[model samples]
Target: MGKATGFMEIEREETIERDPNERIKDWKEYSTPFSDDMMKRQGARCMDCGTPFCHIGMEIDGATSGCPVYNLIPEWNDLVYKEQWKEALDRLLKTNNFPEFTGRVCPAPCEGSCTVAISEPAVAIKNIEQAIIDKGFEEGWITPRIPQIRTGKKIAIIGSGPAGLAAADQLNQAGHTVTVYEKADRAGGLLTYGIPNMKLDKDVVARRVKLLEDEGVNFIVNTEIGKDVTGDELKNSNDAVILCTGAQKHRNLPIEGREAKGIHYAMDYLTISTKNLLDKKINNEGLDAAGKDVIVIGGGDTGADCIATALRQGAKSITQFGKHPQLPVKRGSENMWPAYPQVFSLEYAHKEAKAKFGEDVRQYSIQTKKFVMDENGELESLHTIEMKKTRDENGIFVFEEIPGTEKVWPAQLVFIAIGFEGAEDAIIKEFSVSATSKKIDAEYGDFRTNVDGVFAAGDSRRGQSLIVWAINEGREVAHQVDGYLMGESALPSVVNA
Candidate 1:
């Protein structure tokens, strides 16, 4: 719906980033703003495909294929191309509660599934999205829309994450009294702590939270339900309770020297680093990575973040271990278009590591055998073995260690970024909610738990997922809760809409 021939005329230009080597010296965001003209050019690249799949918002081959929030990609692109910045921002806010977060961190499955991507590079939807919202903020076009009517129904949301915040926003708009509970001293959950500041600025998160507060959403931080406040108490006080606590129980490496003093979880490291930055504390004590050889286990976004954080902390050297082999430069046969492409590319953190270290820090096809410690039980080094991927009898892929490829590397600190299993057991049991080992027991479309007037959503119910998916569930669950309370709901369902 942009320029009919713009896709063919203009080459795709991505948002530029600050010099990696220069940006690693501080914690500021790496991405630089796109000029309005550049943004318009990028938005003009949207092709007028009869059937656009960029906003389909579905799964294919067990991976997210398009925008999970069901953003109106083409519509927004056309508005942006036509220089209607206000209209573009309106369309953007309709689907996404926080475009700022997704624009910075989301992998942009919409671009992967774009119609133009079948032949050439896709339209810069994510960058254009950021420009729209950033412009809205810059122009003072966005403000708190306090609901004029109150339904007198109270809904208690447990979690200040993307999911919980989105639900609170929607329910508050529907004139329900919404109070969000956060265990952390500050809200925004992972957005505030789990992710490093370089990827997403904490100020951006705080700005949204402040707007929510102005819009009549009550946020009570540093209060953990089931500990500071019992789940039953919340249920008795509120008309409906929605659990948005994310999947936070991290997977651990239970190998040799598991109890080493220098080893820590990636989230713990990131949280401490962010907290120290926010609190203006220079004393990292044992958690700081300065002058130490850092080894990060498990390769993912978290692992990459560890590498970047260690770099910023002035680590001597860094290495990341991954069980899987390196991905192909181009899309593999199994990973077709429309599914998020599994290809080799450097993330911002990886690029920073390379710029600082003069080589990529990631070491693929390597498995950590054990963490070796000194006589005093301090981490000294680690042993690893190269692995080969092979399919088993049932056609399941597995990594097999190559016996002769074992080697040792010196290290003083280690960070485990393996991933998370699911929501913590304590929360599930405290709420009397049924859940499997991996996720809470709730159907996707209907987020009801076993308890009456209770609901669940986001990573806690869907396992570890994208920020956009969390927002989607939050919006959907608000619709469900509103309908349950009033026997009808005017809130839009992301899935059904």
Candidate 2:
């Protein structure tokens, strides 16, 4: 630690976000970069605990409790506090391949497990992390580190998302020729489309993609494997193939009036809006929500994004519904230190919604019974029922409808953001890889598939998860692939949990 009592002396600070009222007017990143002094102050809040759970990367209560990438959190925090930005950036990159992305988007479980959080607010780890990498770029410390030697081994990575990108970066560093194929017209997979632009700027993603290209990783966009190219072709041409295709198979709500015209999947709505923006189209390709009442189903980041997107598009009103009850106002006794706290909180999109609408848009314990359409077959309302969790005959928990709680709410557009099921079946079938449910049947920790020299990583291997987890999978799988190629490998595994 830079100063022994730094954590005690300093109070945690976060990056300043643009006024939500003003930010909702446009689709741009809302957080401003912190000043040099602010960055140091935030970094100084890290305690450098004797047993730092911040970077432990363990699974707790069926969810991650710390940084899944095992980021050197305390080391970098202290380095930043000491004004050793270059060293901080170096330490940050030792594990995470893309701090810029994670810093902006990650939920920051590390903060939840921070020792400082037990008594007071946690360290501004995510802000400090972003600051370190941003400073490195500003000072021209970050540059392409092209391998001095070529191993003559070629690897193909399917999907240009975080996982694929991380794996490609690692394998390329090991002197292997890595090529990434993305089905979308642009790289970054869900990063390019699934997330709204206001949260993560597309320019930042483009810049990173260009840097990866400079480092000698070939990216083939709009060329999907098993369609534009065959899986067998990839296996035949490359020494090994790693599938990083994210779990994008969205779960559908097949309720009554499900065929209404105004109903759409959350990804589809988000994707078209982004595509239109990137293509310089003024009308959003006819998916505009201007002057329309909107209701988003499910309660998660994606649901919040829908509300934000609708607001930006000039929606008349927006409401969100969740099947589960609202979380407690504060962390419960059962979820204290070192565990991700289950408490009431508002993310960026929700804040944006509240700012525009003058109230929180969330309505919990409600389930959509059906989509009610108008005479034109366009969604006009939603029939819903309140729910409460209760014990079943087998002592298992289940959601049961509460009688006399049925209600109908007006809505012109509806978005289902209930999350994904798993990877698309078509791609999985094409690869002929064994799978369990929606995920690939790869050995845990080892991302190998049944097919020889074929591996799976990211959401394709693990179900729907955080971008950080996907990056971890990509890096770990690259090690396995590297070892298989050379009979030994020097790439380190990040998963110690």
Candidate 3:
């Protein structure tokens, strides 16, 4: 598709990122693009394998490999290699409803399953995808095209997260009236508020939102369905309601001394920081992050983001701790291609942390037994001990503290990123909807909730998961809703169930 020996001749050229020290000076996005020529060569590195496992999106032999959203990887790579920017965008957008978001945030399991990644490094699929979209934006190819005819049905989406947005996009295209309700002040729930500005700019979210608005989707901000409006009111207002509220209840460490000022939930920290940044930029709100020792617990993406954010805030020092031991640089056999390798991986946040703090991550297996306190009920430090992995009574693996390995670390500020438990129960309870475990009670295959005319998708229904899965669930739920209202649907079934 590209230069005949491009794969062998030109090595993989990764996406360009700003230096950590330089990026920490601003809250804007830290990513830069490789030159057009570099992206083409990287695309050319896509091998013409007999079986392109990367795009299959299957659970084969108890080991998964492939794009979860079933992106047309090979076709788009070929188009990129051939320098067909417009065509590449078309093909990429066919499967992935939000390339800009995924290109920036998705881990790109497709690249891990790449035939070349077994020996050589994988082609930069994600970078190429981003480059294609950026060009689409630059060339003015991306625009809102409202449907010609209306189906005369209205859809109310409870959350404006990826899943809700995806469902609204598809349903709107099928000529349905889509209204997205966000509890936050903006259209994007997590994207605009929860995610730090350094990773994804709020303006970028605004841009997409504007396009959706132009495409005839109405967004209601700062409204909770059960509080501001009843679930029945939502049902009466719209032909269908799709729940996209993400799983947001922060998981607790449940140790003694949890009540302290400096011990903050990760989401709370991110939301406050983002709101401060936006208010300062637009409304002149005051916020600061200078000269404090920051300790982030839980070595997930959110933790990495907190580390990067603390560095940018001019922290005196930054340390990240994980409950588990360190991971290998590469995937082990049990964690092979297609399935997300449980092995270690690094993102821009880590690189930024390393650049600013001299250590990429100060991870620890033994962590806080309890939050130590100074005078007046303020957090000062943390007590800890060494931990080991052992089989529990059920023979399932568990982490436990060992005797005589106690230690303590200075923690001026602590951010916990232990992930979510499930969807918040308040709205669900007030709405009189039936929720069990993670998801709402609906038909066996349908997305309908026990409360008639209400449907749920994404983290609200599927629990905490990847953005790709949220988008897929949203698309599928939208189709089900469409059929329920109009007795038929033109929307594609993005998910089998």
Candidate 4:
């Protein structure tokens, strides 16, 4: 939908990042914005393939294949290429409520499924998207659109993360009275605290929250649903209740010495670090990795964020352990086109750590055996063993430790970034919502629970997933809730798209 032959003429160029050595001194956004001309050039590279899979929004081989929100990517790309900035912004906002958040933090599965990616670098869709929204805000084009009429329906959404915020935005726009509840001091759940500021600035999240507030969405912070307000009370007062509490039950390593004093969960560490930064505390609060040998267990984005956080805190040394083998440099046979590529690439955190430490800190194909503690019960070091991946008799993949490959690494501090399990049990039991061991019992499209007038969405319903998927569910649930309340719904659903 962009230039007819632009894909053959233009090359892909990503947004430039700040110098790692200098950026490690303070907490600030790492990536710099692209020029207007560069953004247009990048947008022009979108091939007008008859079947555009970039917005397919489905899973393939257990990996996300495209934009889960079903963004009008080709339309926006064409608009951007033609310098139709306002139209591009309209198309972007049509599906995504918060492009600023997704633009910065989302892994961008759309790019992986781009048709151009089959033979060449994919179109710079993410950069063009961020540019469009950022420009829209800069030009004062984005303003709160207060609903003209109220449906007299009250909806209470638990959790202030991406999913909750998206649902709130949709419901509020549909003329429903929406109140978002956050247990933390702020409104944005994962966006405000779980994620580090350097990756997504708190001001950015605050801006969206302020917009939502201006648009008639009420936010009640520092209020626990089951404790501060009972589930029965909430359900009786509100016309409907949507649980977007997210999957916050973190997974833990149960090895020996796991209860060491210095060991902490990655979410706790990140939340405290962000709180301290926001509070402007003179002395470091919570777990500080400064001048200490830090070891992070587990892999993925959380582990990388731990490395970056420790680097900023002036850690003496850092190491990360992952049980899985390193991904291939290019897409393997099993991970083909249109599916998210499983390949080796350095993220922002990895680049920063490598620039500072003169090497990558990730140690793959390794399993932690036990955490060694000092006499005071503080973390001292950890023992690990190299593991080899093999197929068992039933064709199940397993990691077998190699004999004589045991080693010890000094670690004064340890952070477990092993990911989350599911929604906390307390919330489920308090609401009497049916749930399995992992997620809330709710269908994908319907999003309705066994309880009348109650619904569930996002991670709490689907288990741990991407921010885009959460937003998709949030939008979809809003549609279902609107239909339940009004007997019909005009809201758009990405699932139907």
List runs of model 4 lying over 4 Å from the truth.
282-286
TM-score of each: 0.99, 0.98, 0.94, 0.99
Q: What's the distance in Å from true for residue 94, model 3? A: 1.0
Provide the overall lDDT of each model, using Cα atoms, as 2-decimal numbers. Answer: 0.93, 0.89, 0.80, 0.93
> Candidate 2, residue 115: CA error in Å?
0.4
Tell me the tens digit of each residue's lDDT in model 3 across 1-497.
44556667779877778877788898878888667888888888887776887777655444346677888887888888888989999998888788888888877777778777777777788899888888898899999988999989888888898999999999999999998988888888888888888788888789989999999999999897778988888878888888889898789887888887688888888888888788774331222346777788898888888877777778887778888887888777867665656666677888887776677666757677899888888788888887887789998889888888998888778889989877888867866778887556664248788777888888887777778777878878877888888887777774543
Can you write out model 1's per-residue Cα lDDT over 66-133, one digit (the tens) per residue?
99889999999999999999999999999999999999888899999999998899999999999999
Residue 101 in candidate 2, Cα distance off native in Å? 0.6
> Residue by residue across 236-335, what tens digits does model 4's lDDT show?
9999999999999999899999988888999899988888899888454448998999998988898899899999999999999889999999999888
Question: How do the candidates rank by lDDT, highest first?
Answer: 4, 1, 2, 3
The sequence of per-residue lDDT tens digits that candidate 2 reaches over residues 1-497 is 64678778987776699999999888889899889888888887777578889988888877789998999899998998889899999999999999999999999999999998888888999998888888888999988888999999999999999999999999999999999999899999988898889888898898889999999999998897777999999999999999899998999999899999888898899999988878888666446889999999989999888888899999999999988889997788878768888889988888888888899999999989988877989888989999998889998789989999999899888889999999899888998998888899997578899999999999988899999999999999999999999998889875422
Instruction: Report clash pairs, candidate 3.
Output: 64-338, 64-339, 65-338
Give the TM-score comparing model 1 with the true structure, all chains together: 0.99
